[model samples]
Target: DAVDQARNFQEMLKFDGAVLTKLDTDAKGGAGLSIAHATGQPIVLCGVGQEYDDLMQFDPDWLLEQLFE
Candidate 1:
């Protein structure tokens, strides 16, 4: 549901990139892949925690490794 909502927003706004939040809580991160695929946009950043400094740049290879882990 959230992924679809995000995809719609991305499509409507034509945003440059996606910022996936709450990554620290999403252990599997299946939704992240779905959103990325559906949006057809690069995930430029990820919010790992509530703190501002917890955000990190999204790397495709790194994310793939994490997903498999």
Candidate 2:
């Protein structure tokens, strides 16, 4: 569904990258990665909490650690 949504958005917008949210949850966050891959766009930012202040630059190392740990 995320991939589908990503594709739909891509069709509708002229954006450069994605802002993935909900990284603080139990979700593995793979959908974000998948969307990036599927759309050929980088993840420019990520949300680690419920606040706007929690938004941060995308970090591949952190995602790798989350996946492997």
Candidate 3:
């Protein structure tokens, strides 16, 4: 196994505060939820659009609601 070479995603997790770019979409927001939960981190922001100002902060519950709705 490449366990020794495996890099921890903690830095990415801490830096992101939950808003993962790869999962930035209306659907499948669950992916972000899972990552945050698994890493025991909180989601404070999300960039769901293609603009600097589009990047916005969100509560975990609100993100979940968006996905659910």
TM-score of each: 0.81, 0.89, 0.61
lDDT of 1: 0.83
Poorest 10 consecutive residues of model 2 by lDDT?
A: 21-30
Tens-digit lDDT track of model 1 for 1-69: 978797789878988877889988996677887887888877889988899998999877877787788
Model 2: residues >4 Å from true position, as ranges? none
Among the numbered candidates, top lDDT falls to 2
Candidates in descending lDDT order:
2, 1, 3
CA lDDT scores, all candidates in order: 0.83, 0.89, 0.58
Q: After superposition, which runs of candidate 3 have C-alpha atoms over 4 Å from their true positions? A: 1-7, 11-16, 22-26
- Candidate 2 lDDT over residue span 1-69, tens digit each: 999999889989957999988888845788898999989999999999999999999999898888888
Query: Largest TM-score belongs to which candidate?
Result: 2
Clashing pairs in 2: none
Ranking by TM-score: 2, 1, 3
Give candidate 2's TM-score: 0.89
In candidate 1 the C-alpha lDDT for residue 33 amounts to: 79
Model 3 C-alpha lDDT per residue in residues 1-69, reported as the tens digit of each score: 111111246644344455555336545576666666666667677777787877777656666677677
